[model samples]
Target: MNLGIIGQAAGLYAVTNIDDILVLALFFAQGAGHKNSTRNIALGQFLGFAAILAVAVAAAYGATFLPGSAVPYLGLLPLALGTKAAVQAWRHRGDAEEEKQAGEGGPKPLEVAAVTFANGGDNIGVYVPVFATAGIGGMSAYVIVFLALLAVWIAAGRYFATRPVIAKALSRWGHILLPLVLIGIGVLILIEGGAFGL
Candidate 1:
């Protein structure tokens, strides 16, 4: 289950059509060989990822320190968060549409990082098992997962930047649908939690 969650974090970036990749690639390409927007985005994503890793690791380790009965509540954290995100996305469909229009005006680096953070939110739930397990080398597992995610992110970014048809479509509907899909995923996680009696 934990591996599934971690793999989702990595795979989601790759499965999205080439459009997201191009936008991200353009971010990096514009910043080519100098301090540019893409560099900032890369920096932001790295820092954001670091923040996520810290939180996930802490969650895992802390769970080990807590009583057995407390584990279920901790397990509920991701489900609750995912549910809330889904609800927010559903409620803010208009905002998403507006943002799509506004996105044409300019690219935002911080926004990229924000999106990256949102994309990675599921990591929290995946860490619970790692933190609770002793001598399982949680750090090693994190490294493996991070490397996998990085590869997928880079490949997708490059592919979309080079492709036109895929890019156009992604620009049109990616923002609108990505959140809905995430919400569905969150609900699925929540259901899984319920099954575990969390």
Candidate 2:
């Protein structure tokens, strides 16, 4: 229960998690000008982050059982999701209003959670080593810090959703951009992890 270590862990998480702000902003922006629920986004983020923590903990304990190569393949989850969105976007390219309306139901909480978890491949990469070293108490502190910061993360994203300029652009182009971003993130994860030796 060292406050200093928790603060340090929180800072480390803040630094490493900057990109998540963009992903979350995009998620929050998904139903721009529609009835999107911030609750879903926040809850999905928590679930996703919780999943990442579980993976890191599992990796810490089961490092011998899982092959190093297997980690990167986790990228496929987001890749598949992004590709689906991209194809749907292409199919309805001419029907801009309909496309927006289709998204009005907003991304499902599970969908958001999956994307968030899949995109966290890098976080797992970093967390595994930390968990290996942190021991149980320190790990618990880090987990608490991570959960605390998630609130800030969601707040920032919701704020971004409120901005007129950002909101408008997301409203106009989010359908196209969201999928590409997700796919790019997946590819980057695979590349970074050296999955398939690519």
Candidate 3:
């Protein structure tokens, strides 16, 4: 039982990392002013996290297999996403400046959901490790971690969504930066994946 508790604690510790914070911040910022979209993102993230959990458990339990060394391949996901973001940014470069003057056109529910899903791609991988570590014995611990993360995630979203200046600035620069941010994260993952010779 004590070992189970320890396992749970370890899982929680792993999931609540700096990466999670940054990802949460990006998602929150993107969701600002779009309640339905934020809701969808939250739901998507939760579901995505759950799916990763299942995959992680399968890897651990032998329903699937990957050498720990192969985990780095996940880096490709972020890299691809980041590159896509960069391309999108490039494609919409002119629109970005024009949109600033035009102001937020209107609430875009579907677009918000798509953006949320894209932002969530990286997070899904993060959850995989947590689930693999937590396992059936540590389900409670995983739930606790999930709830804690969810609270902070939603609160961050709410706080930023309500801030006029922050919202305005994000509205203006978000298009320009989101792709770059994704690209940076992708590069970081690739570097980390290779740094120790993954």
Candidate 4:
């Protein structure tokens, strides 16, 4: 294993994905009390990141793939999801029974995966050139390190979500805050990518 490659991968993943810790915390907060929520979150995160890596690898190899201009439109996934969540939260406001029922199932794995993939526009952009420059051995090392660190990221998010003070706050306000945050992230992505001319 190349220690330098591993270090580079670790640093890059940490820098690129620091914001994901907060997002994961919010997801965990919403899924509190639901069975298999953590499992689904981890699975979704892996699947989504794998897709991003696959794309980066392919692009590195000069495979024709998604055009750069089309990347920004991926923000629609989170935008739609956030809008739906907001509508649901509004409709169920003050209905403890309905809210409890709604929270019973947690987010679907695919839903989490879609959001993860959609949020990875910058990941793809950053990864492609790095992968292109990396020889096959270095690329493999980077992949291994990145995958391992993903688990650490998930655990950190869960830890934050389960903290007494944060948990209490999220329990009270996560529903509202989650939708707003998702919407804000979506808008930021769109604007940053210059989608629809912002």
Instruction: Go through the candidates in order and give each one's C-alpha lDDT.
Output: 0.49, 0.82, 0.54, 0.86
Q: What value does the lDDT take at residue 77 in candidate 1?
A: 38
Q: What's the C-alpha lDDT at position 139 in model 1? A: 56
How many clashes (backbone atoms < 3 Å, residues ≥3 apart in a chain or on different chains) does model 2 have? 0
Where model 2 places Cα greater than 4 Å from the true spot, the runs are: 33-36, 62-66, 96-99
Candidate numbers sorted by lDDT from highest down: 4, 2, 3, 1
Which candidate leads in lDDT? 4
RMSD of 4: 1.4
lDDT by residue (tens digit), candidate 1, 1-198: 277546753553344322334445644432333335445656555665565566666676663333444323332433443354445445655665555344333224554554444445555456556545633554555456665666566556646644677546654554444444434444444454453553
Per-prediction backbone clash count: 3, 0, 0, 0
Show model 4 residue runs off by greater than 4 Å: 101-104
TM-score of each: 0.46, 0.89, 0.64, 0.95
Top candidate, metric TM-score: 4
The whole-model C-alpha lDDT of candidate 3 against the native structure comes to: 0.54
Ten contiguous residues with the weakest lDDT in model 3: 100-109
Residue 125 miss distance in model 1 (angstroms): 1.4
